[model samples]
Target: MNTHAQSPDKLAEKILRGVGGPENIESLTHCATRLRFQLHDGGKADQAALDALDGVMGTVPQSGDRLQIVVGGGVANVYSDIMSLPAMRGSGARPPSDAEVKAAMRAKSRGRFAWLDNFFEYLSDSFRPLMGVLLGASLIIAITSVLEAFGLIDTRATDKSSTWVFVDAMWRSVLFFLPIMVAYNASKKLRVDPWLGAAVMAAMMTPNYMSMLGSSSEVPGVSCTTNETLGSEQCVAKVFGLTMQLNDYGGQVFVPLAMVALLALLYRGLQRLIPENVQLVFVPFFSMLIMIPITAFLIGPMGIWAGNGLGSGLAWLNSNAPIVFAILIPMLYPFLVPLGLHWPLNALMLQNISTIGDDFIQGPMGAWNFACFGATAGVLLLSIRHREKEMRQTATGALAAGLFGGVSEPSLYGIHLRFKRIYPRMLVGCLVGGVIVGLLGGVDTEVFAFTSLLTIPVFSPMVTYGIAITAAFFTAMVLVYFSDYRSPEERAQANAERDADERAARDDSAAADVREPLAVGAATAAVGGSGASAGSPVAAGAPAPGEGIVLAAPVAGRVIGLDEVADPFFASRVLGEGVGIEPANGHVVSPVDGELVTAAVTGHSFGIRTKDGVQVLVHIGLDTVQMNGEGFDVRVEPGQQVFVGDLLAEVDLDAVHAAQHSTITLMTVTNTAYLASVEAHTGQDVTVGAPVVIVRR
Candidate 1:
């Protein structure tokens, strides 16, 4: 029974039951502001009940058994609460493994372009592992670009000192051997032996293969020529009387990507054809025999032709209609990146660099990257102004990651996607920046660089790149600042919650000079007293002999036994008898007027010594200290005298949910050994100030 001490908890309970209980849930995970549930049976879930739940932003029912519960900011706390439920324990249906879950998500994709999804996923995974190295290389190039700009050193110098030579190699290493990296990554994506892919790509880069190019007359079976339009030398070599097309495969991603794909197919075929005993030896032998020849004859030439054709087509558009092409790329990237569909474009950029000596797309794309960081900057500003501690931390980390590392995934998944409003504002910034770049005849980079502010020096006419990215950054920051990322209702809710916390604080402060609580720790010998009315908010008067002193309910909700709580310390009775309340609302109030003892800086846990000689500890949530005071606001200081109903802290359960912690609040008598008896009135609903625990002498 999910008690309705408040709306959010009650809603959580209803959603659970509506979803056919914990037995129907395969697993639960939270991302930012939503609960992603993998259900055993999708048909068993009641969508209406889930929609009707308070604090539920919305429900997104995906294909198959995946369900997303948008619980706003407190999604993490709500997910924890759901998992903390006793019903969730020992669930009969086992959750899917990570691989299985990914497969299931992939299977759920349905559309005319389902193959596009798979293709993009393959491309994304292949390149994803290389993002770090790519960023490092870009930064290194930026350093050299800066050096050249300042006249400190010549980056184009070939006969410089050994140190300069090695420094140049640092950035060139990743760019020059990019094909091998791509081949390895693509092979891994195809579930083939990655070394084979690297080896095949490596064959073309070797001095032996490269040596064949200029020896057309000396080597009877070889011929070489440069393509008039493509500006790249092409060679044909005859090996064992077989004619083969050859090109320097360095920095050429198209060839290796094409080769590894074919390799996967041929390798798998050979594996099926060969006997198991010698399959390993025969599989590679056949793979090399079949794939090498086929690649040299077909895939290699086709890759070169394909890359040149695509680059030429895009370059033509950029020359004729620069504005449209410029805006198109940046806008398209925002959509493409989330689906991992941007890898092909990235590969194309590298292709342009290898063939045409430069790339145009990266310059305009910088506009988009800066815009993303700008939106994060705006959010960071808002968080500071409003004192939203969690949002502040999230935006700060994301901003740093973007500006320094040139990675957008942190901002994309961490902040931008979470708040729907950020996307529109960010798009506007991208548009403005692209238009500026296009009007300036479109910026181009002489090298393939990660389009970041730091890499601005790499772009030709650095002033153009600088101006465009600046416009993008300020546009997005200003838009987000003026309009704000959250909707009006969300802002109103936040204000209301804050106002309530303030009101509770004022109420507590105004009545600070009241009488002392019923008793101090002296209750060990003073349990003999009369009982108050059970119908009152709290059983306050006194207790009979051997009767435990009644401790008012710290929070409102259904009370479960200490053994039922998810915490080991409480469940093991190490913290004495106490009741866990699945909170309906988000507030931690004084159960009785007492001196504050332990006041955690994070505001998640508090210990109060009651006047009745009982030490009580109020824990807001399970493992919530990790949130570092994000969703909690402590109202009272340590040793401060507080009366009954005084607000000890104000919690944002939504924030707690967002942090991925359980909102099961516990109030325990820590020093039960000092008392005669400690009894709990559990297995029933409770409200703030209601008698839930009785500590007696």
Candidate 2:
């Protein structure tokens, strides 16, 4: 099925139906080219029907109720459409409960080691929400760096202007308070009281904690020593006779992540042991009392060491194997970002900036960001050349987001991931950029800045950084534009579809001039508004019986070809030409505003007759009659006036699955032969109330 002509909303509705509706969806997520559905019942999905739909590249039925529908390039729009449907209004994905979250962690099998997925997901969720503030802070640092480069301001001056200090605070506030923010998010992810986690981390950052960091003989049981090589001071203070290492926790991410994890365990354990009613008060009190000390004395020092150990290892690698380090970072990021494994490296960058006053990772990482944007630029050029409007729009937006914001997700998910050929081309660009940076003694930034065009000034040896990113951008662009993102066969099909759409558009424009405008008043008079009683048919010179009749989808799901129907009678269009929906849910709605002429007692079928004499039949399953009314709940009576999207029936789809019957719901203009034209839009995922069929007479 080719769904090129369908809108994203229509495509989403059909996809939802194909996956067995929002009720069946345990969770919904999208990546690159596919809509990942965690379904409650995978068996209810009509895989063959979904594969036959337009716009859908394929369907993958995984273990459990996991289903992935490949939409390619425009998966984000499709995902949004599905979630915005009326039936899915409140059923869209939300934060799962603690048990559900645990189950999800257990179910993730993205890698050979399942725990790897959980680890990355945990790290990703903790920092993902902080992106906005981080980007804002990076931009502030970028502005100051630009001023410094241009000699407009001396940022390094000890006696700085108040305005400069204020500007510094704007960026520093985000970085300094970052530990508390990470603690909150990490705690929420672990289903702990986020405030308790934030409070525990905050205790270390208070002025009271900062007062302990000194080598003064006046302060009892406190000592400090300077590391000659590192040129940094280390201090220890006696807390209740236990020696506590005192380190500045500003801009520390690892500490909060570690602290929150242990805190979650303790917090939950307290809940289990304490009385349910009193647990609320006691849980927070006991958790803070216990975790605060543990974190201050143990986790804090360990987290610092862990962060330092990782940063030092990378620093050593950069010092010795600079070339490998440069190439490896840029090349690795493309894969890491998608799977969310890059958070550790990101943590290291922050640690380096906090401790050593500079970070080297972001310099190499700019190569990957530019390469990703470059691939999108290539796709945009190719899309323009081929006149692929959808791809052009997607690519243009993705490229802009990447270049300006240094956010790769839009480019990666919207364009690069959809095309396999682009990755190797993009990687070549990453390698070239990395090589240039390595050969030029590498680049370093004093601030944790995003490697966007605006933040380029933040990196030292700005000329080397510029050259590397420029090379990376153009290299990927040229390679992708010349080679083409799509396979030859795919390109041919796309061109053919483009040609068809153009031809149809021309025909519609030409027809619009000669044909009379739709008789809206006449049609409305006859059919009335949604709930109003239908009046008599219109007279001549008014709209015809079939004219201006738009049949909406009866269920949320993918609309497939009549031939995809398992029932021979329906498949052959013996009753009429129409579309078949692989339902996403069991609640079927009326597809037209008309009188319910026939509502089967078994609830397997319904026939509606519009005031203008247009006839429509909605058949819910193949050979479901033998099972009788065991699974179906009829919602409308024969002769009842109904409007589009009015509930008609609710079928127990699981029962149908057990009966080994197809849950493909069919909608047909049963009197198709008499109509001038009955256009059934198929091969699209659509929501209930989305137009699926149009008739002209």
Candidate 3:
């Protein structure tokens, strides 16, 4: 991947054509790998053309006008390039951010079971935002557990010192106040007043409400019984001639998620029934008055009952057949995420955390995430070997997002879905990882956290979780990397493309030399002959006026297309078309027979104007001009005439390196708009006098 020059500009143009151009793109955003687009009409996109593109791994047309272009790793660059296009210049073509994409994706869960979708989303959204804080709290739990293991603290003591009590409350706060947070988020998700939702849920946890339940001591209209399963006293209050189940909804996630869904329907119906004149005051009053009672009497009890049943079911499976339970979770997730079926399982995770004090689902879920990223790692290795720049970037970004962020959408759509072979290889890693965790007594966590490398410390028996995930990551990485992701035909096609690109670059020097008249040497190769054999070098010559222009590399280095520069300006090709060289030596030379137009006093850049009407800027490194000529020596001034390979400046690369500056010499034709075409020859190394770009007029 590093060997090739990433060129998203041209790739973006191809993607635009395949995607039915800028007009069709209503909105676009990239995650880890794929370019997600919400189009005006998905039917207008050319599937075959997109699939056939050199950089594109594959495509997925989702329900409605949602389309995904699998561009693994380099999607960010491609996105930038697409945004910089002249057609996308207008404000109307500007796409939404990734957050908007996620929000929209959450919104599109529809159909007869739309309420069910909204229900699951309510739970997910409620809990999702709190993950970081919850994970931090979980780590504190882990630390205390570790201390308790060493007898450093009497963790089980009923009476605690002020310091220990404060320490315990740190983690307990997350669980104690969970209902209020869930209520707020769920209400907002359902388009209701969040504060009202919090207020209603808060009533259940109040001292007065708990007091009415009658603890160990007896009270009027209250009764208590021992619950065999929980081994805790269950209490109830008799109100309005009916006994209502009294539950501690402190850490209960399901109750609020479900309760808010019901509240939204009741609230909306009330809005319609009541007249608009007095709606605002009465709507909140009637909705809360009616809904809070229904919640306390019915929904609250039902949610606890459901959570227990689901947790007990999974717990039974985990107890009896741990391997099957573990394997099934990871395997199902791969299929679940794309169709949005995974939300229910995610909800189940929160339920487990709420009722059982932890969730096992996230433990096994790590295997699938690692495996997905592993497949991407495999794709990246191959892209580097065969010089597929776009894929390399796509895979790189997706893998990083996976390992650190615990996200999977990028790898799933970008590489796995596009190349069917990845799924089988990736699943095997998942199975092995799950099997490893299962056989080793299974991994568990005390608090809910995303399964990421950073959260590994939160899992109990850290050794087991570490080994299992490491096995998963390496297993998938090795399988995908060694066996390769592409089919034989696809592999051959990619190899051919790489080989052809290399040959074209090598040929550019000799081809340009042979095509032009040799006034400098008074001799030239056969003008009308067929293409020269491979291994030909640039013959000395003076080009005819109409002959295509040849731009030489200004320094010896590995030549890459402008897309790999990590600067949006160059990667997007706003200046012109060109190549970037990671300079191996320190000297800068003239890349063309041109007159100097300008030269910066800082000595980090240059500008040249050719007799052939090509204006080129040779920028040295990224933001090196900020160095203020500390590491550079300028030899040429403005209006100086120079030929190809003529000395322009001598750079102190050691100084540049010490100063943390890149030495990639970027030579771009600044006036490309007036030309017929400017093509940069990339994916190969070059030296001074070697053809790095071909400008056709």
Q: Could you give me the TM-score of model 2 versus the true structure?
A: 0.51
Q: Which stretches of candidate 1 lie above 4 Å from their native place?
A: 1-136, 152-154, 157-166, 178-229, 234-306, 329-428, 439-466, 476-551, 554-576, 580-678, 683-687, 694-697
Structural similarity to truth (TM-score) of each candidate: 0.49, 0.51, 0.42
Off by over 4 Å in 3: 1-98, 105-124, 142-146, 212-218, 311-434, 437-697
How many backbone overlaps does candidate 2 show? 20
Please provide, for model 1 over 624-649, each residue's C-alpha lDDT reduced to its tens digit, 9 standing for 90 to 100: 86665677787876557877789988
On lDDT, the leading prediction is: 2
- Against the correct fold, how does model 1 do in TM-score? 0.49
Query: Backbone clash tally for model 1?
Result: 19
Span of 10 residues, lowest total lDDT, candidate 2? 524-533
lDDT of 2 at 624: 78
Cα lDDT tens digits for candidate 2, 652-693: 999999999888988776555456767777777888878777
lDDT order of candidates, best first?
Answer: 2, 3, 1
lDDT of each: 0.68, 0.72, 0.68
